[model samples]
Target: MNPVATWRRLLAELLGTALLVTAVVGSGIMAATLSPDDVGLQLLQNSIATAFALGALILTFGPVSGAHFNPVVSAADWFLGRRTGTGLSLRDLAGYTVAQTIGAIAGSVLANLMFDLAAVDISAKTRTGTHLWLGEVVATTGLLLLIFALARSGRAAVAPAAVGAYIGAAYWFTSSTSFANPAVSIGRAFTDTFAGISPGSLPGFIAAQLIGLALGVGLLLALYPDVAAAAEKVVIPAERAARRQRAASRR
Candidate 1:
């Protein structure tokens, strides 16, 4: 990719991720503040906000950077593209991941600042145990499956709504409330709030998410082998435009 294009994509990833984390952390704080006595209401409020914000963010940034906003999704795209040479290059993958992580952290800090709290604080909420890990696995597996399956089925256009809806539902259903994204998980660790997770518990959550990612890839391979072409359309708008141009030239 050209330097300008690469920079644009990176900026998209960073800004998208930062906004996403801000939604997650900020909504959690707002919900907790407003619904101090009702845990269920707090969760409901937070989940709704996150779902809406995610969908909007995806719609805004999907055309520019694919709107991954998650490390696992980016890695999945890289892995799927490796064979067909239609996805992100190794260098691009690295850039996306780094940008996402930084964005996530910045988002956490921004949310804290918005609430007049410290910019960075270690979370005290300790989310652990086998059941939680299992929850993480299920949440992440479903997330990956939904993403890749949509890509394979030529329904990438609906990703904004579909992904946001799935995540919103997962929040209520999953025991861990679906911290499926490693980058998001790390960001949440920086806040000591209703949605925060303790730093010590980060490893287990990330490991489970990785396992889920693997399972998602395995299932996609087993069921949608022919849809590898669709996988190429997961994101990366520049490539999509290039492909369209090539087709236009042929016509």
Candidate 2:
């Protein structure tokens, strides 16, 4: 594996999370500040925009970094035996979590600055509850199903589109605006601005998403038992072929 590339991938995650959070919170604030009349419409447009950007980013950088924009996705991939380098180091998880959270908070702050809304809490406008919980299940399940289809078909090439479309559609169809990510959920909680989950809403929302992720992985695996075979081999071996050859000659 390219060690340099690995670091680059991690940095990409950092940058990607920043960009995602910025766009998401920015759109929400714009809706509140500008199109308050049709907040729903604005949110829909925002969701589409975010989904497209995320999809394109994943397509562009997936080969280099696996395009794991969400911590949950990274964790899921590791759980399913995709990312195998020491398998989720505590230090890296902490670093990634901090990066995602910071990026999220910075985005909200920037949105606040741009909207000039007198430090209003952004979470007030968010949707959550048992309804939101069910939405999480629906949205995340759709994501996992789409991903499972792509992987099992040996269509890793189409993963980014599959994932993006799933999220985009889930946003509307599920009645919850489809977060489907734990890091993003926590980040959004810091604000009471547009698209911010009410501070009171964050914990249950996070729990729902985590549960959805677990169930999604489980369901996808159950449905596609052979999905792992289609996965690209990135395993590191103990011996180099040249070393094996020299040993055979010595023997």
Candidate 3:
């Protein structure tokens, strides 16, 4: 791949992630402030904002960088493509992860600044225990399953809406409110707000998410054995359509 293309992809990942975290943290802050007396209302408002923001962001960036604002998604793509050498390169994986992590943190800081808070503050919310871990596992597993299955079924075009809808629903169903993405989890830890998770709880959440990633991969392989076809479907629908048109014109 061209170095220029690689850099452009990395920048897209970074900006997408930053905007995503900003939506999460900023909305959480607003929700908490506006509905200080009603926790349920606060959660509802935050979840709705997050869902809409995520769908918009993915639609905006998927063509450029797969819109994998989550590290687990990126890692899964790399692993599934390893044998065929058609997915992200190891260098791309590393760069994406680093860019996402940095973007997440920066997003938290930006949200805080926008709300007239400190740039960075440790969260006090402690989310732990077996049930929460189980929630994390279920959330992350379901997320990966949804993404890969869509790719395998050649429905990547619907990913933005499907993913966002799933996440919004998971927020109500999952005990942990679906902190399924490791990068987002880390970013939330920087805010001492309604959406923030304590730094001490970060390791456990990440571990559960990783376990979920493994399970999701196993399910993907078992259900979609044609890895090559699945990989090809990862491209956005517009690009795929254009390529088909070009091929037909050539013939």
Candidate 4:
């Protein structure tokens, strides 16, 4: 395979995140429409669709950018690999973050337009309370742990299925329905559908996710003492890096 370029990596992150958000918001709207009277059924439908879409997206984009659709994930990669220079550089992390956020917003607008709703309807679904915040922390922590653990264990090949499975399960287990991703949360705020979060709730949820990042770092240190060595392969191996190694070996 050809080495992936920086622009290709950024584009992968942008497109992957956009599609992920579209799946989330779109499925929620479809679920609500299909099962108007049954909230439980709607949630199930939404979760299933999101899970499948996420796994497919990761598989499609993993080699290009390591499939980091979440800002915290990219941050974690940079932090862990700073000493070793194995994971993303600071510049790459910044680019990925910007692309993911912009893609997420665009995704929300697209979802809304598809459903015949206002293109930029701000969500009014205020999700508050300490419980919800705590849920976000738990969800984020678990997600980080899973990703890092898989990388460290050399099981990154299964990340698509594993990550998708975890998020799907977290939806039912976490009170906040596993809005562990800040970009996703921000994108969701642009829609007033079942997956939407009020703009007012962004602060608390984002803070909780940050806290989760801290805790995840601590836990990863204990669980995978040398996780930094595997940081470059977190979600998947970057195609450019992998190609460079092959070229050096052949030389």
| Candidate that would win on lDDT | 4
Note the Cα lDDT for every prediction shown: 0.87, 0.65, 0.86, 0.89
lDDT by residue for model 2 over 1-251, one digit each (tens)? 32334466666666677667767777776666677788678878787777787788775655545555666665655566554443334455555566666666666666667777544465675465798898887777677667656655645556667777777777788867888877777677766766688767777777777888788778867987755542321111112222433585799
Question: What tens digits encode model 1's per-residue C-alpha lDDT throughout 1-251?
Answer: 22238888889999999999999999999999998999999999999999999999998888788888998988888887778877778898899999999999999999999999999988999999999999999999899889888776656778889999999999999999998999999999999999899999999999999999898888877888865565567665635645655696799
Displacement of the residue 23 alpha carbon in candidate 4, Å = 0.4
Prediction-by-prediction clash tally: 0, 8, 0, 0
User: Residues 1-251, candidate 4, lDDT per residue (tens digit)?
Assistant: 21468889889999999999999999999999999999999999999999999999998999878898999898888888889887788998899899999989989999999999999999999999999999999999999999988877766778899999999999999999998999999999999999999999999999999999999988998888899977877633455445545685799
TM-score of 1: 0.93
Estimated TM-score for each candidate: 0.93, 0.78, 0.93, 0.93
- Pairing residues by index, what is the TM-score of model 4? 0.93
Query: What would you estimate as the lDDT of candidate 4?
Result: 0.89
- Candidate 2: residue 223 lDDT (0-100): 85
RMSD of every candidate to native, in Å, equals 2.5, 6.5, 2.4, 2.9
Cα lDDT for residue 170, candidate 4: 96
In model 3, what lDDT does residue 181 have?
A: 92
Evaluated at residue 41, the lDDT of candidate 3 is 94
| Candidate 1 residue 200 C-alpha distance from true site, Å | 0.1
Cα misplacement distance, residue 116 of candidate 1 (Å) = 0.5
Off by over 4 Å in 1: 1-4, 238-251
Which stretches of model 4 miss by more than 4 angstroms? 1-3, 235-251
